[model samples]
Target: MTSRPGGRSARVREAVLDAVYAELIHRGYLGMTVENVADRAGVHKTTVYRRWGTVDVLIADALDHTRETDWPVPDTGTIEGDLTAIATEIADTFTDPERRQVPAAIVAAALQSTRALQAKQAFYTARHTEAAKVVTRAVERGELPPQTDPLELVRLTCAPLYYRIFVSGEPVDRTTAERAVQSALAAARTGLL
Candidate 1:
């Protein structure tokens, strides 16, 4: 059957994804269920079951929907400014209590489910590709070598913040964000990245 972009199916998908995100944020992966999601979405259990089948699929679909959403890449006219903006965005996100739960839940779900893991990987891959535009611009402007890997630079700028937040349990503020940007930029400038 042919699909309409803004028809009933689209509306149902959006509602279900929104409900999944809310469920993940409030109840997390462990507490969330397919019935709860369907009820929260105002849809029948069978509809959700036929479309999503399971909580992991629901969460993965939510992540995929989120990945497809528009994310404005920073354009500050300088690599440092752009990368700092990117890193700062990450810091701000995880530092917030409610917003942090979404990704934390994604990570937790990924550990237990291959579907969630693939979704998480695809989400980051899309984000990295989009964020790498700044590094590409930097190369164009002669700020970095043409051989520099934009994805690597983007990954480097984001790695330390994730490490601190998920591993070392350290605080990540604007200072930490800027530091990560600087280190990544330095590595790129030195032909290390």
Candidate 2:
């Protein structure tokens, strides 16, 4: 669906996605409903159903919409600074009670629906692509080897954070973010990533 910026359709989409986000955080994928989103968005239920067709599809679209506001590559002068910034950005999300639920729900939804899976993949792909630019800059600065894999470094940096929250059920804190930065930096320096 095409929504011109600042148009009524854009406003409606924004409202629906806002409601979807809140529902994902509070109700999760299985519990989130189009009716609930419509109610929260103050729109007719048929509007959401007609546009997205299913809860999973609506959730996917909502998640996809988040990319515009999500992860940004830091332009700090050093690779260490950039990695730390990136890790901190991720850590902050996991540490925030409200923000954390979104990722958790997305992961859970991906396991159950193809649309959610695609959304999850697209979300990370965009994030990784943006974050990889930091490493690409570092390579140009001679901080990393010319052959360094930017996305590999990006993935390594994020892997532990994801594992900590999703698998180990551990708290994601500033220290956790720092450790990931250290590990990924070491790996990048050693050409291990």
Candidate 3:
């Protein structure tokens, strides 16, 4: 099926991203090629090259697009509640089989390529920045201590989830996520974080 030129840009991007994601899952990072993604997307190789310029950029963009959209950070006026919300979101993404594999490939690519590392850093920076705002709000509400480090808190809250997703290869559920959040909150309350 042919997509309209200007009217289907967003749709075309989504199709390309989906194709790239599938290729990443099946072929792994090292095996993924722009030609393969282009063929899978039913778009020309030149179109893919013209749009993304490089395979790393294309893959990074696909990974970023798959992440939860406009997910609001929780601000329930309690640090525990906010952490719980954050943990829930993390668990939801990690437990999804397709979604889980994308990050694994991205991390593998990042370790081997400077461009991938930079792209991953930029993506995480934006995500953590948003998360920091939530922590900042909690601090303002007196839920967390005045000197609480927002970035550290964000890391602490997500460390276990990432560990489980990447290392343990275990399913991340609401229960597991809640535990991570609870652990972070406990540590924070005791000045550990």
Q: Which candidate leads the pack in lDDT?
A: 1
lDDT of each: 0.91, 0.86, 0.81
Error of 1 at 104 (Å): 1.0
Q: Against the correct fold, how does model 2 do in TM-score?
A: 0.89
Candidate 2 colliding pairs = none
Between which residue pairs do clashes occur in model 1?
none
Pitting candidate 1 against candidate 3, the one with the higher lDDT is 1
My TM-score estimates for the predictions, one after another, are: 0.92, 0.89, 0.77
Write candidate 2's Cα lDDT for 1-193 as tens digits.
Answer: 4457788888889999999898877877668889999999999999988998787787788888987686556998999999888888889988887777787778877887899999999988988898899999999999998899999999888889989888888888889999998988888888766
In candidate 2 the C-alpha lDDT for residue 22 amounts to: 86
Q: Is candidate 1 or candidate 3 better by TM-score?
A: 1
Q: Please, what are the lDDT tens digits per residue for candidate 1 over residues 52-125?
A: 89888888889999999999999999999999999998899888877887888888778878999999999999
For model 3, residues 69-148, the per-residue Cα lDDT tens digits are 57576777777887888888879876776566677788887877677787788778878888888778877888788788
Where does model 2 exceed 4 Å of error? Answer: 1-8, 26-31, 68-71
